[model samples]
Target chain A: MSAHAHGTQHFDETKRANIKFSAEALTTIENLMKRYPEGKSKSALLPVLHVAQAESEGWLSAEVMDYVAELMGIQSIEVFEVASFYSMYNLRPIGKCQLEVCRTSSCWARGAEDVVDYISKKLNIKEGETTTDGMFTLKTVECLGSCGSAPMLQCGAEYHENLTEAKIDALIDRYRSEGTRKNYTDLNYTNSK
Target chain B: MSRKLLLTHDNVPNLHTIDVYRSKGGYASVEKALKKMTPEEIVEEVKKSGLRGRGGAGFPTGMKWSFLAKPEGVPRYLVCNADESEPGTFKDRYLMERNPHLLIEGMITSSFALGANTSYIYIRGEYFYVSRILETAIAEAYAKGWLGKNILGTGYNLDLYVQVGAGAYICGEETALLESLEGKRGNPRIKPPFPAIAGLYGCPTVVNNVETIAAVVPIVNDGGDEYAKIGIGRSTGTKLISASGNINKPGVYEIEMGVPVEEFIFSDQYCGGIANGKRMKACVPGGSSVPILPDYLVCKTATGEDRLMTYESLSDGGFATGSMLGSGGFIVYDEHQCVVRNTWNFSRFYHHESCGQCSPCREGTGWMERVLHRLEKGMGNMNDIDLLVELAKKIEGNTICPLGDAAAWPVAAAIKHFRHEFEYHVLYPEKVKDSKHGHKEPIMPVKPAPVMA
Candidate 1:
């Protein structure tokens, strides 16, 4: 019996009823699980979580984590510990477009702060805050290995590199009009440089 | 103007396609490896080639392969470490993005040599597009009979898949990569029974960097002796340098091991000199983990000998005035950039990335970050410098992984080379508070050592 503030740890049966994967997503998870040897289907947990995140509302809720564990036939804490460890698995809700700007050494050396400031001003949101309309969330992440093209950010699978004010403006307007939740599982994603 | 073993056909149209890659003799290594040569012979060739691990450790690739234990029906594995999250390094992504099939071809040939029936390419999660690109290529490889079930009719059954990590820089370490792949927390395991003996569900496994696996293609096609003859001394073959930060041409470059550092920095073929026409201040020749070298030591060693890109020449001064060619992440800094600030930024990164398994790295990196932040913000006394140096020394060899050493080296090197800058921030707080980027170079006092009080 954990408190409600410890949302990821507490398992609510009503919330569990809401967890459902699409037919396509279920197939993807099953195929991923089959990729490993027998009884080691737990190895598919990371990839399955990716699929679960994409198929859901773009974050891992308590129910979603439990469903993933149950779906993989493991303990709920197994999924909870892993989701908490990695940077990509968003435990709470995020805006549709997650702008992960690189603020590490190379990117910082080449004006990554300016890029972050510009986006925060344009979206009228501070770093780690979401816009009122729920279209954008600004985050400053460490290096995404796009050092050659410094001052870059990742939205879903799209890599917006070589950031300028004009480029960021165009990116904001583009995502604003598209109005769809962007995610890492977007297979058709492209580098919008 | 260097020999391009990996990216020779980079500009070729449709190079990403299987037909074009095969037309250029792509799968020739697999054919030679599985169909003709014995597994032991292939290992011997790689040992003769003298290629070191391109992922920063500089361990001999062939020696590593030779160490794989083969005890009675235990399935061996070859996992390609595509977790390329090194701050100034992105060559693995570039190689995989540009020529996906080359890595696949390398995987097949290497897997055959190691007798691994199933293998995986563990790439970073943020590179979802690159994962898609690799998945497409792997699918193509399997379709063309280069990956699964008796590849090239050599009775070699193999299965290859691309596994993406969520986002963890620590996963780039081989054991941690295995841990993540096994669907667990990526805390790196202690060594005694190394990965070669006990890895990937208690089976023998050989983990290699993507570039290391891809280089196997050229090594098998041409004889290892021929590959060994390409570069200078023990640092054999061409290496991909991921050049970034304050440089005009900041991209990946494949250079012969003997290339002079001066030419590589100034030549139009490489970095094309410092950006904004600014005077060079410093450079981290390897990734952020290695020691940072000042301008004077970058092009030439402390002994007045010209610095070459080889492992030996880059590390000639032994961490006193020298650094390693680690991961080939050539990050340059100009005069306007502050060493103390950059050191702070890097310490912040290591603090954020330390897996927190070991106490010294966990606590030491946090202390170093806070002290560097105070020193950078012009809010500290001079004693903070000595404290940082002491903390780094305590943390250097105290962790389970090299990440502790990685976190320690940059802070120690920055203080060793730029103590005057830290003192300037303390002595002239008003001058530094507004302009942390770099408020003019500091003029040292007649007395070099700081007053303890």
Candidate 2:
């Protein structure tokens, strides 16, 4: 039921510094582009937008998406079309820590509804609402393929599996104290092993 | 006891690394296919092996490969489908996480067989960390001259890359996957010119599930005939079953086909019997999209034959008393679990995931979810139950892709097998609201409902 950002606004060059990818992110996008054939850099748009969203506070604003379009040599509508289609892409602003709970059949069979309610009551916000202090955002996503460890929630890029009410409290406390921003691109990319 | 083709070395330490993997004969298939076997020979062996797609459709993998429309000078592609978003499935994740090189090796051999100089592993976006694991494994392969140009000095040059897709379940379909690979919305294209004829970038492409591709490693290591002899007829080779939802040992297990459903659930080596020593009520033997089966029907077919894990045995009754071995996502429900609520959950999932390309799926799924929401909330009348069934029947076989049928089967099956539960909510609205979603109460039987005309 949630709506994502559309490319109603034009790209702003002045805000480019705030939306630029890190050096490592830039290299990652460049290498991803090479995976396609010549004149097919548009294939890199999904991964490139992932890098852009990760660089800019964990969600895609209009300007950030436009910049990703420019970087990937695609049009702005191309970026918006992709960013809105997938549930993983957060179009609007989100809190510092986004808690996406798996609310599909297997997880629901093993008490996923209770987990959603517990997190909602604990965080004092609804399923799609952010907290007052911008510390947390609650969302119910489809399957994340961790059904073996059912009743799970994914925070940032990490999956907290076989979750319970007690685990939710501990995770919330950990994230609140850490007080740092997280994004999908926060992977340990340099791990050779 | 069945043989472990896929998970034979799942417990090995550092199996994810290239050195440990190579030490354990990981790339032997790649070497055998590249240096010794011709492309036609490898394809012939696969055809002889009888490996099927592990991504729920159960189509023959060899047949899929032979359909490649190889026009001269246009580069072919071999894309791995790692978008394991099916609700009860996570075996591909387990395989990719524990043994990344197995998949990489499988892709290399497959690419060589198809003469696809390029390959991509299109993984789901939520598995970003697993994507990193795959990326590291790919880098190791490139360094060892296993993936990039001139692989293993056999004149078979292939390049493999990992592409991540954002969260769309419909992208698991082959054409939809190709569309997603081209960085578009995950909408499926109409077939007839299948992905083999006009796939990614309008070239010939072969898309396979991660497990289906990984099986190539064993199919090539052992002879194709030897691989074909592992399981029952047609359903050859081993399968990765991801057991979840109220099962005692809810994890990924590799089993040769022909194992009985009863032994699979109760055997100590597998699911360790149902969780909490509870009585098994029902199961979706495949992923959530498959029709569900009651406990009595799950172990035996309508004709009293013991239901084996093979595809033919699983679908013995043709959605009346049997289900499919689709994607091998085994979800067991104990007596405490409620079918109506679980069906509602799945309906909500399908509603959320419909790509809005087809009218029946786009509207019917939303309608089913809304009607089921009312039924689960105890505010529905008898008409709502009939409406749910009507919507499911109308939605089935009315879309460009099988997602329409996938969305419809669960709802139709739930009504067919658990109509008493739906009627209970309708007749006892007050009691339904009093009991929460997790409240465990036996479903009381009522008079048989009239079958749809």
Candidate 3:
């Protein structure tokens, strides 16, 4: 894993300079900071990461993580470690629509496997592997605390549950067709919604 | 209908003040512990009570406290592992949010027992509201002279702080939590010098679960021997089981240890049986990390004893037959649920949360997830079953932390208990169509590209 980091060119300082947290992100960080007493802005690391990841197109970059570290007045490595350590904060670029499939035990017994298999085959990529077209990335995640609806997957933020091959196929077809229509119309379709 | 122990009076009239808690005999334990008992006596009481770590591992809490290296003149630390990241587990969140003072009282008592002057509560990142609740409660405790220097004029000074983790499941591991607390990466450090000996800035530290710490208050208040008498041998005391999924009552239910699984699941006193009259299929008795127990094995074990929710009884048949009560995440599955798809979903979670710290975990989790993904998508072959097992084995014990084991146990258990599901996907590919979102194409072909070197 360290080797992958070695060959990749280090992020340029100019790229780092242009990375600015949006107003919403800054406000969320400030609110989280108030949760702690004075002189403990570092306590906001996780909330800051959450806001940053949300603002930076659903994933985090090394430069953005470093910038968060600077904003929180902690070591850059501290922020990097957190971003890389968690499965939620994506370090690299992800597909336009990220599929978070809950593969925990309850979901597993509820036919989440079929949903995953259906999604992967439909998208033409295995888990953790994004499609060449960059439309979707197939990834499996742990329980998203929604065990009541087993066999569930979270696309962007909305959860689609009781998933079967047919249900998954239709959902994907709708998203794909919607993407194509938006492309032709030049309408900005926010995938998260 | 009885008064709630933790969150009983969240809706009670005028119940949020320190005076209300005191009126209900809340700080009586703190006053008694401070005025009467010595720190050693408190630790001995806990030891006598048979209180175990409520944080899934079931380590003896008193034994853990004893493990602290006591080299004279060296400072020791106490850290409450509030980083409750276990899947299907949310009891700690409720405890912090509704009954924050219970945890604060417990922390103070536990800290006094450990002879620590400073402590921290490492809460999960997503529990933003709970963190604020704890902070306010801490301020309240400080105002009452229970947390700050010379608490209640006991001369034992202590300071407590709340630290938030960056939402990594691995940080729930004690050592990784310590590392995160120190403003470092949340990776588990190799153990030898366990956290008890050298933790949290290289001092003797005791990292305990929130429930474990909170239990201390009750134990110390009621006297350890009295508390020990409540439950069966070794597993004495009550445990908070977060029952969810296909249950008539889905919430944190506190029951005395050694309650039979049949009672816990089917009894009106507990989970109130499977929801909507669905037949029980399987159960992840513990959190998502433990193996799944099929309906046949969910009953009494070969010991001719009904499976109880206690740590020992739950582990009776090991992973081969019985599941653990780990973190007490009781997730029940109805027969309508597909085992293959459920396992696939769990595999995806492990793969995503692998942290890429070790080769086997990083690569193996990804591999198992992909194979399971294919099987779910109806693109699996018979060989893929063997490959998934092999990949899980590779990741099982080959990582820096137990996160690898956490990821592999579910996969291995799923395949063990539900092999036919994998076979079903392979045999009837047409039945498992594409995801509802897109064209029906194979996600992973019958064969996948070899993991990148």
Winner of 1 and 3 under DockQ: 1
**Segments in model 1 whose C-alpha atoms lie over 4 Å from true places:** A1-10, A187-193, B439-453
Docking category of candidate 2: medium
Fnat for the candidates in order: 0.78, 0.80, 0.33
Instruction: Order the candidate numbers by DockQ, best to worst.
Output: 2, 1, 3
lDDT, residue A79, candidate 3? 85
Instruction: Write the residue-wise lDDT of candidate 2 on B199-226 in tens digits.
Output: 9999999999999999999999897999
Candidate 1, residues B42-125: lDDT per residue as tens digits? Answer: 999999999899999999999999999999989999999999988899999999998999999999889989999999999999
DockQ for all models: 0.53, 0.62, 0.18
TM-score of chain B of 1: 0.97
Report model 2's TM-score to 2 decimal places: 0.95
RMSD to truth, every model: 3.8, 3.0, 9.3
Q: TM-score for each prediction? A: 0.96, 0.95, 0.77
Clashing pairs in 1: none
**What tens digits encode model 3's per-residue C-alpha lDDT throughout B94-185?**
67766777788888888888888878889875454566667777777787788777888879888887766655777789988887776666
Error of 1 at B373 (Å): 0.8
Model 3 stretches astray by more than 4 angstroms: A1-78, A87-141, A144-193, B1-17, B434-453
Candidate 2 — which pairs collide?
none
